[model samples]
Target: NVTVIDAPGHRDFIKNMITGTSQADCAIFIIAAGTGEFEAGISKDGQTREHVLLAFTLGVKQFIVAINKMDTAKWSEARYKEIIKETSNFIKKVGYNPKEVPFVPISGFNGDNMLEETTNASWYKGWEKEVK
Candidate 1:
């Protein structure tokens, strides 16, 4: 039998969590470069955040941190480096090796750092270049 599903762990449907985690071969983490951060903790009614952070924390082997929203932050190398610094610390706390982590800052809003020639990312290399 072969079936696949795509949905996050949440009160609306947390059942996916068990099956998703158990069956998935790998995971890709997509974080925004500027905003869209959902605070880590239980909500007012005690509902925990259904976020990829937990999955990443639990040790997803093939996690690629896609930092979206770079245009909003102005596509600066120093800013991206700062994001790397903070994310590296978080990855360590979540039981992952910071050295093995990779990051690519992309602006989904403006498509600035997208799948094309990014004029501003002179300081950082492209995503395909990361693995090699």
Candidate 2:
């Protein structure tokens, strides 16, 4: 049996985020891949860093980072690489091995690489199969 707790990323609902994460064995961290949005998320005041720190502190170790909004980024491989490069150090600092973690590029709105392979991201091969 699997239970999914969709915790809110908003700073106002940090209590809810803690409650959800404490019960989770793993976290599927969805990071935006859009031009400016990605930077904003990893900024000093961003919720992304806070959420990751919270999950780690709450004893959740496993992470599958979904680089979402690839569609908005026009499915650019360079953008995907950029996100990975920028976030890898921070992820490692938060206690996850950068090599072990799967950074899958996805589009939540367009449904790319969610449950199936997306032609839009042909370069992002093997992750879907390996993850499953």
Candidate 3:
């Protein structure tokens, strides 16, 4: 069985994020696919990168990089690939092997690629994790 806890993404919520990381067994970092959002979130001043670094430093080993709102990007496989490639490099720089991290393409609004599959991401091979 798995349990999930949320950590806020804003810079002002860094403390809460750290608190959540401290208790988390795994980390799931979300990147938006909307125009300009992803870059802004990973920028020097953004909290996304900082959160990942903190989670890593806090010894959260397993990671899931969820690329959300793919529907806004028209469910383009190229867009998904682009985000994954860019984010993977950043993750690798932070000491995690990019290949070992799971990259999930999801549309939170439509609920695609979560517990059920959808043609919205036909190119994606779905993810399944064995419960321990």
Cα lDDT for residue 41, candidate 1: 25
TM-score for each predicted model, relative to the true structure = 0.65, 0.92, 0.90
Candidate 1's C-alpha lDDT? 0.59
lDDT of 3 by residue, 1-132 (tens): 777779988778888988888989998888898879988877886667888889999999888988999999999899888888888788889998787778888899999887788787778986565454
lDDT ranking from best candidate downward? 2, 3, 1
- Local lDDT at 59 for model 3: 94
| Cα lDDT listed for each candidate | 0.59, 0.89, 0.85
What does the lDDT read for residue 69 in candidate 2?
Answer: 97
Error of 1 at 36 (Å): 7.6
Model 1 off-target regions past 4 Å? 1-5, 8-18, 35-53, 56-59, 127-132
Q: Which pairs clash inside model 2?
A: none
Give the clash count for model 2. Answer: 0
1 against 2, candidate with superior lDDT:
2
